[model samples]
Target: METIQRTHVTDAPPLPSPWRDAHVAVVVPTYNEAGNIAELTRRIYDLEMPGIRLIVVDDDSPDGTGALADDLAGQVNESHPGRMVVLHREAKEGIGRAYVAGMKEALARGADFVVQMDGDLSHRPEYIPRMLGTIMAAQAGLVIGSRYVPGGSLSAQWGRHRRLLSRFAGIYVNAILKLPIRDVTGGFKMWRREVLEHIGLNTVRSDGYSFQVEMNHLCEHMGQSIVEIPIHFEERRADSSKISLAVQVESMLTPFALRFGRRRRG
Candidate 1:
């Protein structure tokens, strides 16, 4: 397996007692992220945020990411029992399916707040404390780490085409869905447990990256309060991206489906 090297973010000051006491479960869906998972897990635990649990859902990556995650979970659990949980699926399914499974597992495990982030380290662990604080302070059901918001930025490594594509995606989704969120396609987000329960994971239909857009639409459709905070979105720390042509096609079609297809329930 390829190992990823990353600069660790210095530990932030301890969180307030109330935020530290809440059960926060971070659900990360992985495919071929063996190069980055170990580093990612370390950074999350380094936060030293009490009551924080990481649930890694692996899609049986051929590169042995699932096994690496299992080993890491075992080692972490030896000291911090249940701090890390790994769910190994039998086949390589879509990211949406992996997230649904992980989110359900988190809810079953009694997480008060659930976080969805990438395992590739593009979604920094350092921003998590602020996200938790934002949800509490804003009284929002979902808080998104947005790149298009003021003070938000993308990695300089991103080429003009990629940057434009990413920006256009948000605009296209908003144009069709009329959602108020500035970053509709952003993957880094924190969702309150009650919101996930209300939005019924089983009712979610998108099987690809469009999952982000679909979930946002459902939250807004249900009249849930949503908030976006600025985040400097980084490129993946290692390994190639998994965004395939098929996934892109699915993304383009999902908005139309949500707008014109069957009505979704809250």
Candidate 2:
């Protein structure tokens, strides 16, 4: 979990507009993110990215995040029809299941590209443009907003232990899976529609943050082109983290399962 020191970039030049009109879907999985969802929605729309859709998958949070998201989606659709969507699940499953549901919805809605990001605002909306541009420009099946790469950084608010744990998770997963990705555990990623269509989403088994690792492994296993871009990771704007001890345990054992278990298609 040793921190790799690198020069940070303050502003990234906006890539060209060749892919601006593509149907892009931002699939966010939320659990008690009410304090942050509205602002997140605003920032995403404010980008003015054409054909952009926000799909908020809520796990029936006690804070009524699902209702708030539905209200927000309704408000946005009045002026910009079909600009936002909210999927309310029955209970708190795991992030992996939430993402599977949201991704399926996005594809069914005709998303040309799919984005995975946290609803807590830790994954900035501004980076979406760069990620989209990268996927199109590089013809990559996936583009990752990476903190472990050069010019990428974590929140200064993160203490030593948290930082170490995050970094070690990626290193440990890579050591076992031997994937070429630098940020195997990162949640912020952009996927071409075809990649998701072929990744066998329904077959994925991990139900926690390890979902990120499994998806990366699947993409590599399927020989999909992948790219990484530097991003400054931020601390959540509000609400407590949803990560639990069970999630941690699942993440710890996921690599072994993928390596030796019969479910490597995940």
Candidate 3:
């Protein structure tokens, strides 16, 4: 992990940048991603969207990711002030809860839009500008950086089985839910604040990777306008994969539950 020199500020830096003026918040949920946190934060902060804030919702990673996030937040906030907010949870719950907490914080800060991404650097920060552009130009409630889209491609390093499983998951979820989205399992996404507000974050029940599918499902169910922009999906270089057998089981069960059990608009 990169070491960032800590800098302290006397007061919150003035929010006068384009990012702040637009009220854009990027919420990244993390667990044991210490190796990548600094670089990721640097890249996101380097974008320097003025008021663009990066929220790192850490699940109390034993590897000290939360502490590293604090360092990054301190360094970034020292210069940008209020541009980095790290929410350290008591224990590793799930991505769903981490996101809920971060999104709520974004909303509380009066954010107009919120972004969701993985902290392991799989989701490139370069595409953020385009995602934001698409959201505004297309007036989409949700903008997804999709691997299943025409121009999107997964890393060549991914094996056949991994590729097949990913493709199959998207196909299976879409078939069952009849969602207009092609990347039903995509994690790199941007959402208008209203979409999150309307979905009622507290009502979302998925506690594992299924959270991604469930969020997509709710957006489709609520008749929200969504746009998918093709993106290059890179494989993570550090830390063990979080996906496990239990998460896979939940991913499978989520489709059936959402399609049959859930009746509300979410």
Error of 1 at 52 (Å): 0.5
Per-model TM-score on C-alpha atoms? 0.94, 0.93, 0.91
Query: lDDT tens string, model 2, 36-94?
Result: 88888877776647688999999999988888888888888987898899998998889
TM-score of 2: 0.93
Model 3 per-residue lDDT at 124:
87
Residue ranges of candidate 3 with Cα displaced over 4 Å: 1-21, 263-266
Model 1, runs deviating above 4 Å: 1-13, 263-266
Candidate 2 local Cα displacement, residue 169, angstroms: 0.9
The CA lDDT of each predicted structure is: 0.90, 0.88, 0.85
- In the range 13-98, model 3's lDDT, one tens digit per residue, is 33333533577899999998988998888677655356578999999898898988887787777867887899989988888889
Clashes of each: 0, 0, 3
| Per-candidate alpha-carbon RMSD to the true structure | 2.4, 6.4, 5.0
- Give the 10-residue window scoring lowest on summed lDDT in candidate 3: 6-15
Instruction: Return the lDDT, model 3, position 250.
Output: 92
